[model samples]
Target: MSKAHELLKKYWGYDSFRYPQEEIIASVLDGKDTLALLPTGGGKSLCFQIPALVNEGICLVISPLVALMKDQVDNLMKRDIKAIALTGGIHADEVITLLDNCVYGNYKFLYVSPERLQQDWVLEKIKNLPLNLIAIDEAHCISQWGHDFRPSYTKINLLKPLFPNVPMIALTASATLDVKKDIIKQLEMQQPKLFQISFARENIGYFVYETEDKGYKIEQILKKNPEPSIIYVRNRKMCHDLSFQLSQLGFQTTFYHGGLPKREKEKNMHLWMSEKAQVIVATNAFGMGIDKPNVRTVIHVQLPENLENYYQESGRAGRNGEKSFAVLLHHPSDTVSAQSQFIHSLPDKEFLKTVYNKLCNYFQIAYGEGIDEQFSFNLNHFCSQYQFPVIKTYNSLTFLDRQGIITFSQEYSEKIVLQFLLESKEVIRYISLNPQDEEVILAVLRNYSGIYDMPTAINLSLISRKSNQPEAVIEATLLRLKEKGIIEYTAKNNDSSITFNEVREDERTINRVSKYLEAQNELKQNKLQAVLDYVTDKAHCKNSLILNYFGERGTADCGNCSYCISKKVTKSNSEKDSNVLLKLIKEKPLSSRELQQITKISEEQLIFALQELLDNDFIKVLPNNKYTIN
Candidate 1:
């Protein structure tokens, strides 16, 4: 058996790697950097893992998602192979213990965030732990043009030599040509083998529709699939409303989003995972870490900002290798609303600066002093109290955290940055007296190279707890470690600053970028127009036009889509209902409830058909909750 096959069976109990997996695995096994661009559900993890195990050392996997890190690590550990995830979730003491185990135990996979890489100590400690491969998941984030760019991804360059002899593989489920180049350029993969599997999930039909009655359309699709479906919405409120509406319609639906209490989110997630619920109504944040097979359909009530995002979310369907669908529902006016949302979200820097200043003042710190303090932040309260923009301010602070200027992601961690307070030779006597302390100190010196840069904020909390020393001892060891040129530290209090490495420019540039985003918003409106055209287009294959946008060729029309089914339905039910409603209402005013009972049509569907008639001025709604034919 091939070495890859051996690990696959030994760990995952799978008989064979899926399509395009073996090739990528072989390339990584050969100690050559490789980039595997598989579509979502293509099993991108095994591409790196198979070769990672085949190689003689641990694989260092860098990712941006904390949940993804945990899930992957859990899967690997369940197979009896050692894996550890370092995230902001655990206490400092826990991170230290996990790292210690990673360094000294038989662990093979260490999943960490890119932001964690910015810590000099994490870099230092990871430098010499028998690393044979570097696996960068979500490699698209390395690109500035990618939707989820992280500045910490750029810092991954420093870990290059820590595993110089180790082959590296960068894997992503979605990346356009431009995003691929940015990943390559940013990660500095040297003439790596490139493996791109086809992006087409031919089994999943693609459909785009426009109708103001989204609930009706959603109900229509779910009625057909009726098993493990996901309804993607743009906002948390919609997640609740859609789920509630679906449940009210007698569907077993659950809602999930970030804003919900973690327990509620987890409870709903568990229900979905257990297949206790048939459908989940959630924001884009719901499925990032979820890996459920047999998801029959993915429906979107609102268009995403970009195709990358849309593809990732829609790609969640059809993972079971069964025929499924990706449906997009939008209306002509949705574009206007989406544009308004974009404009509202993009706030001015002055307002952002005011919020930042207010936060700093609240913390009772001058600019640049809140290093290493911690707080539980209620964002809504903070925004309302200060009278600054809420969502935009939060976005700005997060962007600053990404830029590595001031770390607000500290909430996820009991964060501390250690600065080596002493020179290497200064603590020689103490290290000689304490060999155990000397071991950690030497590990630091061996791992982290730039100890001379004073105040290089180190994760002393992680180290003290990991090294099993007191916090003061952690502090002293850091001092001793610094004296021995091992590591150094500093801390950022909960304070955050905007550090974009971006040029602070005049209003002209901000306005310019904002306008460019505005134009993109306009193009989104254009895409909505295209959907309008596709729904109404009679010239060519409707499936072809939609799939072609997703970079697939003409295979066949989805016989299931509304466009294809229109010919078969032949009853003209929509028109018949409209005509019948018009005739009845013209005779006298009728309530929608009365109309539904008399016509025997669904209330939601009746409401929609009535609204369309109203829009056409064929009917009008009376002030007394009755409809009158125009």
Candidate 2:
């Protein structure tokens, strides 16, 4: 066997690679820069990973999501591979140690976010590492035309000069032709080999239902399927409300969102992964690197802002190559709501400037100051204080971040720190007095060290496992301990945060990218229109429409999609209508309006049958626009 296959078997335990994965790996092993466009759940990671393992030095993976990085690192570590992810929540000393490990300790993979590439210290450190290859995940983010564009990703080109000899591989799950070209040009790949696996997932049946009572439809769908499923909504509140509704209908359901605490999110995710929950209601934030293969259905209760989001989210189903369903439940009002909330609600340039200025003032940063300064942002408080609309303000901040003026992150894992106020002897006395909380207290002390000297991160789950108690019990004990002045426990806070990348400037600075922002807004409107077209157009094949949107042409109709199935039913019913019309005409001559009242078919179907009869001389129309038997 080849080295790639051997390592793949040894590490990933796979006998062979998926289609185009082996080819991509071969190109990478041959030291060629490659661009891979694989659909979601298509094993894009293995293409770069197997090659990195076959090669000599460490692989530097520049990714956009911290959750994805952590997930991959965890998975690699589980297979006895050395992998580390350097994200925002780590301390500087720990980062130094991790970098040292990557350079000298023979770590195989070092995953960092795109924003970290702009840090001079990080760049200097990376120049010293024995990097064999650079892999960019979510590579489409480098393109402004892509759905999820990040300005920080544009700085990835800086690494090209530093690692001129090393080959680079850029991978994304979804990208159009324009986005693909932009990625190559932005990364400056040298004679890159392109590998695009077809985006068609044959095992998935796409269905769009126009429903007035979505809850009843959802319940009915789940009742019929009754398998592991994911229901995606638009907001956090809807996640909880829908999950609760499902629970009331006797479904083992849970919900997840980005705003939840770390432990709670982990618990809910664990429940769903372990099959303890049959359905998980979540927002778009829930499923980045989720590897559950048995997810039988993914239902969208609300329309996504674009086809890209819908395609990627729906692609999460049928990972095991088994039959599954991606159903979208939408009403007319949903289209209006999505367009208004996503497109029209985007703040104008003046509003964005106002938000930026207010943000600076909120942080008390004067002009020419606050470069690299980080602050915890409370969206509710900020909005209330400034009397600005919450959604608009949030979108403005996001756009500002995308313009590279600031760095905004809302989805980092929260860390809980605990420091004991009492001395060791006093703590022991307190624990002895409160023996009910002894298990949790001792578990915390045993699992995490230096909590008494300084505030250190405490793992509630680990404590729960060690104590053989529920997480709730452990938390209650910690709260009791904190109340008695034995320890100072700080709970995890998962709020949004912002960092100024440059000193505060005038409104002109914010308007520097105004044209670009306008272009993005226009692109968004177009995407929204495409989504509306997909949901509303019933004559075309759903699969073909999606494929065409991504620039894939000449796709045949998927025989199992809702449109194809409905067309088959219509054809059968039309033949029956023609026969019924003939029988009715044989009884006696009838006018068109009289035939319509007698026939049990729709007007369109009746007209179609009448035209067929006329062409065949089976029926004739009189001068009064009446139909009669011939």
Candidate 3:
């Protein structure tokens, strides 16, 4: 066996590499730059991982998401491999120590974000390490034509000259031909070998249903499937509300989203991952870098923004090669909802400029200044201050972040800090004077320590629960106490933070990337249209349509999706049942009930057969509304 296969068996315990994985590993081991387009759950990681293991030096892996990077690092460490992820919020001294470990401690893998590469100290340290390979996860983000483009990713090629001879590998779950070409160019690869496994998930059956009531449909699907399933919604409110609704209906359920706190998110994910929760209702944020092989059903409560997201989300099901389903439930209102959510909320160039200007002004950053300045940003308050629509303004900030104009962190958090001005006995005396504040003060004193020494962060929700008071009332009491100088209190109700990456040059900054802005808007429109077409068109095979969209040709139906199933039913009934019904109808004119009594077939099949005959002019409805052979 080759070293790659031997290392894979030793660490992963897999008897052999999956198809094309071995081939991709061979190409990478040959010191070739490679781009691999494997679908989600296709073991894309092992292709780079095994090669890195076979090599002598540490592999540098660059990714965009902190969560994904952490997950991979954790997995590698579990296998007794030394790996480190240099994510955000790390101190300079700590980063230096981590880099030192990579150089001297014989670490095998180092994961860092694209933005981290922009730092001079990091790049300088990287040039000193003996690099083996450069692995770019979620490599599609490097392409402007890709769905999740990040301008920071485009600068990753800066590492190429530093390690002139090290081979590179770019990996993504889904990418179109345009994205593929763009990736090669952006990475400056020299005649990179391309390995694209088929994007078709044959084990997954795609289904779309149009219904007036989505909740009922969801319940029905869950009841029928009764397995580990995921129900995806569009927003955090829907994620939480639907999970609660399902729990009330007697489902073991949990929820996940980006806005959730770190501890709570991990807790909920643990419950679901341990099979304690049979159903997990989540937004699109739930599934990246997560693998659950036995997911039997994945139901979308609303239309996805695009097919790429749909394919990736649905591909999470049936990874173990058992029969599974990926269902999409659509209502008439969903069209309007999707339009509003995706299209109308898209920020134009003018709107982008307005948001950037307002953001600089909000932080009191003068023009020609504000580079590298960070601040706690409350998105709701900022929008309310300027009377801007919340969604559009948020989208504008996101666009700015993607364009590398700023770094926007949308993880929601609430912070409350408290410090007592007086000693412990003096706090007791003050509480005695203000009896109404006794419960709140006592709860704070009982649950927290060192409040008299310095400002310590406290959980407002926990304090409310402990004091048996509402959060609003607790906030008011704290403000009253602060007003009277009893204690020092600071409350920060912020959903996000922003760091300006460039000096304030409002219009000039906006104009610099206007082409990207226009192209991305047009791309969103096209992608949205493709999703709508996928759900609405019932004549073609859904599997084939997906394959064709990804530049596959000469595809065949899987004989399992919703469209293919319906076609099978129609063919079966039209050939066998239609002739049987015609023979009975020819003997005598009969109403539909009379026909059912004679044929004893299902009403659905009977209706389909009758419609087929009527369309062919072989039958007609008499004046009495009875069926007759024409």
Candidate 4:
């Protein structure tokens, strides 16, 4: 066996590689630049992982997703491999120590975000490490045409000159041909060997059902399948509502979304992953690092924004090589909802300018100043202060972040600080007089060591749990105590923060990236239109439509898709049903309901069959609506 196969078996416990995996690994082992266009469940991580193990040095991986990076690093470490991921929020001193460990600790893999590469110190430190291969995950972000483009990705090529001999591999789950070429050009891959797995899953059947009564339809589908499944909704509230509805209908269900706290998210995810919960209703945030192979069904209750996202999300099913389903429950109103939720929220250039100017003013940054300045940003306060619409303004800020105008960090952390302004005896007397607030005050004093000496930050949740009081009640009690001058309280409420990457040059900054922005918006519109067409189209096979959209051709109709099944039923089943109906009528003139009872078929099929017989003059309708031979 080759070294690659040996390592794969040793670590992954697989006897052989999946299709195209061995070939891709060979190309990388031969010191060639490789671009791999594998679908979502295509095992893209192992392509570079095994090569790094076979080589003598660490593999440097640059990825844009902090969660995905942490997941991969954790998985590698479980196999006793030395790996580290430099995610955000690490202190400067800790970052230096971690980099030093990478240089001297003989780690096999080091994953860093693309934003980290922009720092000179990080780049200089990376230059000192012995590198075997450089891999870029989600390489599509380097292209403006890609769905989730990030400007930091364009700076990845800066490492090419540093590691002249080290081969590079770029990997993405979904990328069009245009994005592919742009990734190559932007990353400066020299004659890169391209390996593209067809964006097709033969075992998974694609299905779409048009229904106004989506709840009933969902119940019907889940009843038939009744396996581990996922239901994708457009927002958080729907996740909760549908999960509850499904649970009430007797299916073990849970829900997940980004707004969920960390502990709750993990608990819910564990329930689904362990099969204690058979279904997980979630938003798009739930699938980033998830790799459950036995997902039997993935149902979209609302219209997806684009085929790229839909394909990736639906592709999550049947990874165990068993037959599974990817279903979409569509209503006519979904189109309008998609337009309002996705397209209408897109910020135009004028809105972008207004938002940029307002943000500058909000931070009190003068023109040509505020470079490298960081501020805690409360999005609601900013919007309310400027009377700007929340969604559009948020999108504008996101656009600016993607354009590299600012570093937006959306990690949420709530801080509460307090100190006792009165003596200990006085504080005790006040708490004793107000017995309702006693438990919370005692909880804080017991938990925080030096609350009497200086202001100290506290965890509100911990206090609430200890005091057996709700967080809101604790806050109210604390406010009451502060009003009485027994203690000092300060709450810093913010959901996100931003760091200025450029000096304030509002309009010029927007203009510099205006063309790219316009092109991206147009691409989004085109993608949304394609999704609309796919859902509304009844003539084409669903699987074939997806394949052609991804640039593959010469595909035959998949017999398992909704279109093929419908066509088959219409062409052949209708004839079979008609014959059964005619024979029954010839034996005895019978009512339609009696015919339905004897045929043991659906009312819909029976009605269609009877209509066909009537059209062909093979049967006559009596005054009582009974069927008889003509």
Candidate 2: clashing pairs of residues: none
- lDDT of the structure predicted as candidate 1: 0.68
Which lDDT tens digits does candidate 3 get at residues 166-217? 9999999889989999999999998999999888888899888765557766
Q: Which tens-of-lDDT digit does each residue in 1-630 have in candidate 2?
A: 298888988987889888889899988888899999998888999988888888789999998775687678767866767788776534456567678878777789999988778778888899899888999999999998998788789899999889998999999999999999999999999999999978888999998876556887688789889889999999999999999989999999999998887668889999999999999999999887787999999999998989999999999898998999999988667887997789878888889889999999999999988776767677889999999998889888888777667767776444568898888899888878878888788888886678878989775434543464655567777778788888898866748778776778867678676777787788888888999999988788888999999998999999988777666546677778888888888887776556667875654466556767887998877655456788
Error of 4 at 39 (Å): 1.2
Tell me the deviation in Å of residue 327 in model 3: 0.7
Clashes of each: 31, 0, 0, 0
**lDDT, residue 6, model 2:** 88
TM-score of 2: 0.80
Minimum summed lDDT over a 10-residue window in model 1 is located at: 495-504
- Evaluated at residue 333, the lDDT of candidate 4 is 75
Clashes of 2: 0
Score candidate 2 by lDDT: 0.83
lDDT of 1 by residue, 287-364 (tens): 765778899999988767666667778889888878888888876567677666544565455654555557666656
The candidate that wins on TM-score is: 2
Off by over 4 Å in 3: 1-15, 77-80, 88-101, 119-122, 366-373, 412-494, 571-630
Greater TM-score among 1 and 2 belongs to: 2
